[model samples]
Target: MSWSITLTVNGEPRRVELDDPRVTLLDLLRERLDLTGSKKGCDRGQCGACTVLLDGRRVNSCLALAISHDGAEVVTIEGLARDGALHPVQAAFIEHDAFQCGYCTPGQIMSAVGLIGEGQAGDDPERVREGMSGNLCRCAAYKGITEAVLEAQRRMGQDGWEEAA
Candidate 1:
Protein backbone atom coordinates (compact mmCIF):
# COMPACT_ATOMS: atom_id res chain seq x y z
CA MET A 1 0.00 0.00 0.00
CA SER A 2 1.15 3.52 -0.80
CA TRP A 3 0.87 6.38 1.61
CA SER A 4 0.99 10.00 0.58
CA ILE A 5 2.39 12.68 2.83
CA THR A 6 2.56 16.43 2.57
CA LEU A 7 5.50 18.29 4.05
CA THR A 8 6.81 21.79 3.85
CA VAL A 9 10.45 21.41 2.91
CA ASN A 10 12.89 24.25 2.62
CA GLY A 11 10.03 26.74 2.71
CA GLU A 12 8.30 24.96 -0.16
CA PRO A 13 5.34 22.62 0.07
CA ARG A 14 5.99 19.10 -1.17
CA ARG A 15 3.64 16.20 -1.58
CA VAL A 16 5.40 12.85 -1.56
CA GLU A 17 4.11 9.39 -2.29
CA LEU A 18 5.66 6.62 -0.23
CA ASP A 19 5.46 3.20 -1.82
CA ASP A 20 6.56 1.75 1.50
CA PRO A 21 5.57 2.95 4.92
CA ARG A 22 8.94 1.88 6.27
CA VAL A 23 10.76 4.47 4.21
CA THR A 24 12.66 6.77 6.52
CA LEU A 25 12.71 10.53 6.33
CA LEU A 26 16.38 10.44 5.49
CA ASP A 27 15.73 8.10 2.58
CA LEU A 28 12.81 10.21 1.49
CA LEU A 29 14.93 13.33 1.45
CA ARG A 30 18.01 11.81 -0.12
CA GLU A 31 16.62 9.17 -2.49
CA ARG A 32 13.30 10.58 -3.59
CA LEU A 33 13.67 14.31 -3.03
CA ASP A 34 17.25 14.53 -4.27
CA LEU A 35 18.36 16.31 -1.12
CA THR A 36 21.46 14.31 -0.42
CA GLY A 37 22.98 16.64 2.13
CA SER A 38 21.70 14.52 4.97
CA LYS A 39 24.02 11.57 4.94
CA LYS A 40 23.42 7.96 5.80
CA GLY A 41 26.20 7.23 8.24
CA CYS A 42 25.16 4.41 10.51
CA ASP A 43 21.69 3.95 8.97
CA ARG A 44 20.76 3.98 12.64
CA GLY A 45 20.04 6.77 15.08
CA GLN A 46 23.48 6.42 16.68
CA CYS A 47 24.95 8.76 14.10
CA GLY A 48 23.77 12.30 13.67
CA ALA A 49 24.66 12.38 10.00
CA CYS A 50 20.98 12.31 9.13
CA THR A 51 19.94 15.08 11.45
CA VAL A 52 17.26 17.47 10.18
CA LEU A 53 14.81 19.93 11.54
CA LEU A 54 11.37 18.55 12.03
CA ASP A 55 9.05 21.38 13.04
CA GLY A 56 12.05 23.43 14.16
CA ARG A 57 13.46 20.62 16.31
CA ARG A 58 16.46 18.50 15.46
CA VAL A 59 15.76 14.80 14.89
CA ASN A 60 17.54 11.77 13.55
CA SER A 61 15.95 11.51 10.15
CA CYS A 62 17.24 7.97 9.73
CA LEU A 63 14.89 6.88 12.46
CA ALA A 64 11.99 9.06 11.43
CA LEU A 65 9.33 7.47 9.30
CA ALA A 66 8.29 9.64 6.38
CA ILE A 67 4.66 8.66 6.67
CA SER A 68 4.55 9.61 10.34
CA HIS A 69 5.55 13.19 9.66
CA ASP A 70 2.74 14.20 7.38
CA GLY A 71 2.06 17.93 7.38
CA ALA A 72 5.32 18.52 9.23
CA GLU A 73 7.78 21.18 8.31
CA VAL A 74 11.24 19.87 7.40
CA VAL A 75 14.45 21.71 6.76
CA THR A 76 17.72 20.36 5.45
CA ILE A 77 21.12 21.86 4.85
CA GLU A 78 19.94 23.06 1.45
CA GLY A 79 17.34 25.27 3.09
CA LEU A 80 19.75 27.07 5.39
CA ALA A 81 20.95 29.56 2.80
CA ARG A 82 19.17 32.34 0.97
CA ASP A 83 19.97 34.26 -2.20
CA GLY A 84 23.30 32.45 -2.49
CA ALA A 85 24.31 33.74 0.91
CA LEU A 86 25.13 31.29 3.66
CA HIS A 87 23.24 31.18 6.89
CA PRO A 88 24.94 32.50 9.99
CA VAL A 89 25.63 29.01 11.24
CA GLN A 90 27.04 27.99 7.86
CA ALA A 91 29.24 31.05 7.79
CA ALA A 92 30.46 30.40 11.29
CA PHE A 93 31.21 26.81 10.41
CA ILE A 94 33.41 28.01 7.59
CA GLU A 95 35.04 30.70 9.68
CA HIS A 96 35.77 28.28 12.50
CA ASP A 97 36.73 25.32 10.34
CA ALA A 98 34.08 23.17 11.92
CA PHE A 99 34.46 20.34 9.42
CA GLN A 100 37.26 18.18 8.12
CA CYS A 101 36.06 15.36 5.85
CA GLY A 102 32.91 17.41 5.09
CA TYR A 103 30.77 14.31 5.14
CA CYS A 104 29.25 15.33 8.49
CA THR A 105 29.21 19.01 7.72
CA PRO A 106 25.64 19.13 6.49
CA GLY A 107 24.27 17.29 9.50
CA GLN A 108 26.41 19.32 11.85
CA ILE A 109 25.16 22.53 10.31
CA MET A 110 21.56 21.40 10.48
CA SER A 111 21.97 20.31 14.07
CA ALA A 112 23.61 23.61 14.90
CA VAL A 113 20.81 25.50 13.24
CA GLY A 114 18.23 23.53 15.17
CA LEU A 115 20.17 23.96 18.39
CA ILE A 116 20.38 27.70 17.98
CA GLY A 117 16.71 27.86 17.05
CA GLU A 118 15.75 25.97 20.16
CA GLY A 119 17.74 28.53 22.18
CA GLN A 120 19.82 25.72 23.62
CA ALA A 121 23.08 26.67 21.96
CA GLY A 122 24.19 29.21 24.50
CA ASP A 123 27.38 31.22 24.62
CA ASP A 124 29.26 28.77 26.78
CA PRO A 125 31.59 26.43 24.94
CA GLU A 126 30.88 23.62 27.38
CA ARG A 127 27.16 24.09 26.95
CA VAL A 128 27.51 24.09 23.19
CA ARG A 129 29.61 20.97 23.32
CA GLU A 130 27.11 19.26 25.57
CA GLY A 131 24.25 20.22 23.32
CA MET A 132 26.12 19.12 20.21
CA SER A 133 27.47 15.91 21.71
CA GLY A 134 25.13 13.84 19.61
CA ASN A 135 27.00 14.75 16.45
CA LEU A 136 30.25 12.83 16.28
CA CYS A 137 33.16 13.83 14.08
CA ARG A 138 35.60 11.08 13.19
CA CYS A 139 38.11 13.78 12.39
CA ALA A 140 37.85 15.07 15.97
CA ALA A 141 36.41 18.40 14.91
CA TYR A 142 34.56 18.99 18.15
CA LYS A 143 36.58 22.07 19.00
CA GLY A 144 35.79 23.77 15.74
CA ILE A 145 32.16 22.72 15.95
CA THR A 146 31.84 24.19 19.42
CA GLU A 147 33.54 27.37 18.36
CA ALA A 148 31.29 27.63 15.34
CA VAL A 149 28.14 27.22 17.40
CA LEU A 150 29.23 29.86 19.89
CA GLU A 151 30.20 32.27 17.16
CA ALA A 152 26.97 31.65 15.30
CA GLN A 153 24.99 32.27 18.44
CA ARG A 154 26.72 35.59 18.89
CA ARG A 155 26.23 36.56 15.27
CA MET A 156 22.60 35.58 15.28
CA GLY A 157 22.04 37.53 18.44
CA GLN A 158 23.48 40.63 16.83
CA ASP A 159 21.37 40.06 13.75
CA GLY A 160 18.18 40.34 15.81
CA TRP A 161 17.29 36.68 15.65
CA GLU A 162 14.88 36.61 18.50
CA GLU A 163 13.98 33.20 19.89
CA ALA A 164 13.07 30.90 17.06
CA ALA A 165 9.37 30.40 16.50
Candidate 2:
Protein backbone atom coordinates (compact mmCIF):
# COMPACT_ATOMS: atom_id res chain seq x y z
CA MET A 1 0.00 0.00 0.00
CA SER A 2 1.17 3.51 -0.74
CA TRP A 3 0.52 6.44 1.57
CA SER A 4 1.11 10.11 1.03
CA ILE A 5 2.69 12.17 3.75
CA THR A 6 2.83 15.92 3.72
CA LEU A 7 5.47 17.75 5.64
CA THR A 8 6.77 21.24 5.95
CA VAL A 9 10.46 20.74 5.47
CA ASN A 10 12.83 23.66 5.79
CA GLY A 11 9.89 26.04 5.44
CA GLU A 12 8.86 24.39 2.19
CA PRO A 13 5.87 22.12 1.74
CA ARG A 14 6.81 18.62 0.66
CA ARG A 15 4.56 15.73 -0.24
CA VAL A 16 6.08 12.27 -0.34
CA GLU A 17 4.62 8.91 -1.29
CA LEU A 18 5.67 6.09 0.95
CA ASP A 19 5.33 2.49 -0.20
CA ASP A 20 6.53 1.19 3.12
CA PRO A 21 5.24 2.24 6.49
CA ARG A 22 8.56 1.26 8.02
CA VAL A 23 10.40 4.03 6.19
CA THR A 24 12.02 6.16 8.83
CA LEU A 25 12.11 9.92 8.88
CA LEU A 26 15.85 9.73 8.33
CA ASP A 27 15.47 7.73 5.13
CA LEU A 28 12.65 10.00 4.06
CA LEU A 29 14.95 12.97 4.39
CA ARG A 30 18.17 11.46 3.17
CA GLU A 31 16.88 9.00 0.61
CA ARG A 32 13.76 10.71 -0.74
CA LEU A 33 13.99 14.41 -0.02
CA ASP A 34 17.80 14.41 -0.55
CA LEU A 35 18.45 16.48 2.53
CA THR A 36 21.40 14.51 3.84
CA GLY A 37 22.66 16.70 6.62
CA SER A 38 21.25 14.53 9.37
CA LYS A 39 23.72 11.68 9.84
CA LYS A 40 22.88 8.02 10.24
CA GLY A 41 25.04 7.20 13.22
CA CYS A 42 23.93 4.24 15.30
CA ASP A 43 20.40 4.57 13.81
CA ARG A 44 19.18 3.39 17.18
CA GLY A 45 18.30 6.69 18.80
CA GLN A 46 21.28 6.26 21.09
CA CYS A 47 23.30 8.80 19.12
CA GLY A 48 22.07 12.26 18.34
CA ALA A 49 23.59 12.20 14.87
CA CYS A 50 20.18 12.09 13.26
CA THR A 51 18.58 14.78 15.34
CA VAL A 52 15.98 17.04 13.83
CA LEU A 53 13.22 19.26 15.06
CA LEU A 54 9.67 17.99 14.82
CA ASP A 55 7.24 20.77 15.63
CA GLY A 56 10.15 22.50 17.36
CA ARG A 57 11.07 19.53 19.55
CA ARG A 58 14.25 17.55 19.05
CA VAL A 59 13.79 14.00 17.85
CA ASN A 60 15.87 11.13 16.60
CA SER A 61 14.79 10.97 13.02
CA CYS A 62 16.25 7.52 12.47
CA LEU A 63 13.81 6.04 14.97
CA ALA A 64 10.77 8.06 13.90
CA LEU A 65 8.52 6.57 11.28
CA ALA A 66 7.84 8.97 8.44
CA ILE A 67 4.26 7.77 8.16
CA SER A 68 3.63 8.62 11.77
CA HIS A 69 4.20 12.32 11.19
CA ASP A 70 1.86 13.01 8.34
CA GLY A 71 1.46 16.74 8.76
CA ALA A 72 4.41 17.61 10.89
CA GLU A 73 6.83 20.48 10.56
CA VAL A 74 10.30 19.05 10.19
CA VAL A 75 13.45 21.13 10.38
CA THR A 76 16.77 19.71 9.32
CA ILE A 77 20.25 21.17 9.28
CA GLU A 78 19.79 22.13 5.65
CA GLY A 79 16.99 24.52 6.63
CA LEU A 80 18.91 26.48 9.22
CA ALA A 81 20.26 29.19 6.97
CA ARG A 82 18.72 32.09 5.11
CA ASP A 83 19.93 33.97 2.03
CA GLY A 84 23.64 33.33 2.93
CA ALA A 85 23.71 34.07 6.60
CA LEU A 86 23.92 31.01 8.73
CA HIS A 87 21.68 30.39 11.71
CA PRO A 88 23.13 31.51 15.01
CA VAL A 89 23.84 27.92 15.97
CA GLN A 90 25.53 27.23 12.68
CA ALA A 91 27.56 30.36 12.97
CA ALA A 92 28.51 29.50 16.51
CA PHE A 93 29.62 26.04 15.49
CA ILE A 94 31.82 27.48 12.81
CA GLU A 95 33.20 30.18 15.03
CA HIS A 96 34.00 27.78 17.83
CA ASP A 97 35.26 24.99 15.59
CA ALA A 98 32.75 22.73 17.25
CA PHE A 99 33.23 19.91 14.77
CA GLN A 100 36.17 17.91 13.56
CA CYS A 101 35.02 15.03 11.34
CA GLY A 102 31.81 16.96 10.56
CA TYR A 103 29.64 13.85 10.49
CA CYS A 104 27.80 14.70 13.70
CA THR A 105 27.87 18.47 13.43
CA PRO A 106 24.52 18.77 11.76
CA GLY A 107 22.68 16.83 14.41
CA GLN A 108 24.59 18.57 17.17
CA ILE A 109 23.62 21.92 15.76
CA MET A 110 19.99 20.89 15.39
CA SER A 111 19.99 19.64 18.95
CA ALA A 112 21.50 22.91 20.02
CA VAL A 113 18.80 24.80 18.19
CA GLY A 114 16.17 22.71 19.94
CA LEU A 115 17.93 23.18 23.23
CA ILE A 116 17.85 26.92 22.82
CA GLY A 117 14.22 26.82 21.80
CA GLU A 118 13.38 24.69 24.82
CA GLY A 119 15.21 27.15 27.08
CA GLN A 120 17.54 24.41 28.20
CA ALA A 121 20.70 26.06 26.96
CA GLY A 122 21.45 28.64 29.59
CA ASP A 123 24.55 30.72 30.27
CA ASP A 124 26.00 27.95 32.37
CA PRO A 125 28.42 25.59 30.67
CA GLU A 126 27.45 22.65 32.84
CA ARG A 127 23.81 23.23 32.06
CA VAL A 128 24.56 23.30 28.38
CA ARG A 129 26.62 20.14 28.69
CA GLU A 130 23.83 18.39 30.52
CA GLY A 131 21.33 19.50 27.94
CA MET A 132 23.50 18.42 25.02
CA SER A 133 24.52 15.09 26.47
CA GLY A 134 22.42 13.26 23.95
CA ASN A 135 24.74 14.44 21.17
CA LEU A 136 28.10 12.78 21.27
CA CYS A 137 31.19 14.17 19.57
CA ARG A 138 33.48 11.26 18.74
CA CYS A 139 36.16 13.75 17.77
CA ALA A 140 36.20 14.94 21.38
CA ALA A 141 35.01 18.38 20.47
CA TYR A 142 32.92 18.80 23.59
CA LYS A 143 34.68 21.94 24.72
CA GLY A 144 34.00 23.74 21.48
CA ILE A 145 30.52 22.32 21.27
CA THR A 146 29.67 23.60 24.71
CA GLU A 147 31.13 26.98 23.92
CA ALA A 148 29.32 27.16 20.58
CA VAL A 149 25.95 26.39 22.14
CA LEU A 150 26.51 29.12 24.71
CA GLU A 151 27.40 31.64 22.05
CA ALA A 152 24.50 30.63 19.87
CA GLN A 153 22.05 30.78 22.75
CA ARG A 154 23.00 34.36 23.39
CA ARG A 155 23.03 35.19 19.72
CA MET A 156 19.67 33.62 18.94
CA GLY A 157 18.04 35.45 21.82
CA GLN A 158 19.50 38.73 20.68
CA ASP A 159 18.51 38.08 17.06
CA GLY A 160 14.96 37.09 18.04
CA TRP A 161 15.13 33.55 16.74
CA GLU A 162 11.58 32.41 16.28
CA GLU A 163 10.20 29.72 14.02
CA ALA A 164 6.98 27.82 13.56
CA ALA A 165 6.48 25.59 16.52
- Put down candidate 2 lDDT per residue, 1-165, tens digits, no spaces: 899999999989999999999999999999999999999999999889999999889999999999999999999999888888788889899999999999999999999988888885579999999999999889999999999999988877787887533
Q: How accurate is candidate 1 locally (lDDT)?
A: 0.88
Cα lDDT, all candidates: 0.88, 0.92
Ten contiguous residues minimizing lDDT sum, candidate 2: 156-165
Colliding pairs, model 2: none
Error of 1 at 92 (Å): 0.7
Task: Evaluate residue 67 in candidate 1 and report its C-alpha lDDT on the 0 to 100 scale.
Answer: 94
Q: Across residues 3-50, which tens digit of lDDT does each residue of candidate 1 receive?
A: 889999988999999888999999999999999999999988886999
For model 1, the stretches where C-alpha displacement exceeds 4 angstroms are: 162-165
TM-score per prediction, in order, is 0.95, 0.96
